[model samples]
Target: MADTNKQSSEKKEYHKKATGNALTTVKNHSKENDLKLYGSCFCPFVQRVWISLEVKQIPYQYIEVDPYKKPDLLLQINPRGLVPALRHGDWGCYESTVLMEYLEDLSEGQSLLPPQPKTRAHSRLWSDHINRHIIPSFYRFLQEQDQQKQVTLADELKTEIGKIVDVADPTGPFFLGAGISFVDIQMAPWVVRLNRVLKPYRGWPEPEPDSRWAKWVKAIEENEHVRATTSTDELYLDSYERYAENRPNTSQVANSVNSGRGLP
Candidate 1:
């Protein structure tokens, strides 16, 4: 009970708006529009959708929301009160991956998913792998306090990542070769944070140079959409301190990790 209360208090006190490049992007999209994205800069899930909107060149208004506060408009769009909620005209939708697919269907921009059915299905399969395996392992490793457990959790994460690498195109960067696709956007946000948040706090090591992991990391780090949506490194480090310390928090991801309910 005390831990929950502490976490609730911290949520109210955390940074409430975007910083650095993300803030600039927010300003650019501040005008009212029928297409809107309710998001918090600190959230990787929100970043996923943000990157998609940029890649697809969809015009949208950015409405920053504090998830803990559960503003009325946010609740109307998503009763769960999560960010990355999409308000299209009178209707709305939430869930990062769902919104990604929704944007792909609604837009005429460069396709994020493959044209062929088989390849598209393959992409979706790996995306599921990322969500079900890689992501949960990431949180578990980040929150683990015991050194021995951390090592085990780290290995689990690496192994899951390796599965994706094995199946990814062997030619150049990005999951499906030179072009960034749904798979790339799906995993990019976490990849962005791995070095910044995980390495310093969890002692997560850098991938070997010239390796596929290294190449892919470089690609995501350099991607224009990823860069535009990301905030300063210091901001991410500060925002994720509670997760690194394994503090009891009401964050959906953190709560999912604690309760073994999978990500919300």
Candidate 2:
């Protein structure tokens, strides 16, 4: 019991705040507002909503929360004390994908989803694919400690990514072509982590230069909004070290992966 408590305390202390560009973004949005985003810089799920807000030019306050500590205020808003919770006036919403959709419903500055129903549905299908397949595979690959198992998991991750690549637009950049859409923003943070965190720690290889995957990666890397919401690569490496080592972690995603269950 003492060891578990100590580990929890250490995790909370280790992940206190965001740094670099993300820190700048947090400062910019520090002022009080009706729209508030409770998030952590170390979280990719939070990044998804953050990117959506930035891309759509939504006016919002950024409130950093240590999810593991489960502050009273955050628990009131999300109950689960999850980051990526959105508070609008008196109402509150959680879940990264749901928050993105809620922001879209506001009909704010820009539209992340397309106008046509068919295209929007298509976009949603792929986004769900990402949530269900790509992300789970990523964590499984990241948290697997055995080298032989890692090899198999790496291939599974690659296969899932390749499925997306195959369905994406044939031309240069973005999932649905020229303009950035919800799908691109949805998957951007993980793409960043794939290169920054997974490569060095898990021996994940970079996509070939001329490959479609590389093109998509280049687009995500060059996105101004994505860059604004991301912290330095070093911070990401430090944040994910526990997952790489397959050590006990309190994160919902890590727990799900470790237990052979679906991501929460």
Candidate 3:
């Protein structure tokens, strides 16, 4: 009882400090309806959770956390002080991927994980590849300013993309044979952001229309779940363009590339 009261007090304080940001709690939440998310839209990790919530049709309260400001409430819930944390009453959990799985287990909508155990394991493997290889390669390609360095990083990124291509199901659309699954959701943000965000700076050509990679991207873009969670291309550019300014040794390149785009 005391612990529950402490949690309630913390929530009240968090709401008081984070007022005007989107925040809510379920008055009568069952297992399905009792979800609250804390994170920012600018974060891809957060977007993953948002996509799952929208896809699963789970009702949730969203509170946009500013990592720079470091809300006490957020810190109290997640000691690591990371975004993409989930809270259900007094219980809280962090880590975007774990939260995605948690939502999958809790919701009764379309199954995000593959039906077969081996296939599900494969999906998890691909998701690991995305987090380990694709995301880092993407960051390197984007933040690099030197032309020679950019070329090297671009080649590395393509190599990673080629691995994805090799592993992809060549039949038609999504990765897990038929419908969208964990791997697709995991990779969606970076795939959608890649060409739109990096092409100008990296000078890397977009994937050819007939390429498997292109087809994969098209399928995800056309997904209702992805579309609902994604921000506009303009917004992505604007947000990341400012982000580029913060990276050391990339200011000149960021300024030069982002100048004509007129994002304010």
What clash count goes with each model? 0, 0, 0
190-238: candidate 1 lDDT, tens digit per residue: 9988988899889888988999989999999999999999988887787
Off by over 4 Å in 3: 1-33, 246-264
**Pairs in steric clash, model 2:** none
lDDT of 1: 0.90
User: What are the lDDT scores of the predictions, listed in order?
Assistant: 0.90, 0.90, 0.69
1-264: candidate 2 lDDT, tens digit per residue: 999898867662235688889899999999999999999989999999999999988899999988888998899889877888999999998999999999999999789999999999999999999999999999999998889999999999999999989999999589999978999988998999999889998988989989989999999999999999989877888888878877776488889999999988
Per-candidate RMSD, Å: 3.1, 2.9, 11.8
lDDT of 2: 0.90
List the lowest-lDDT window of 10 residues for candidate 3: 12-21
Error of 3 at 199 (Å): 2.1
How high a TM-score does candidate 1 get?
A: 0.94
Off by over 4 Å in 1: 1-13
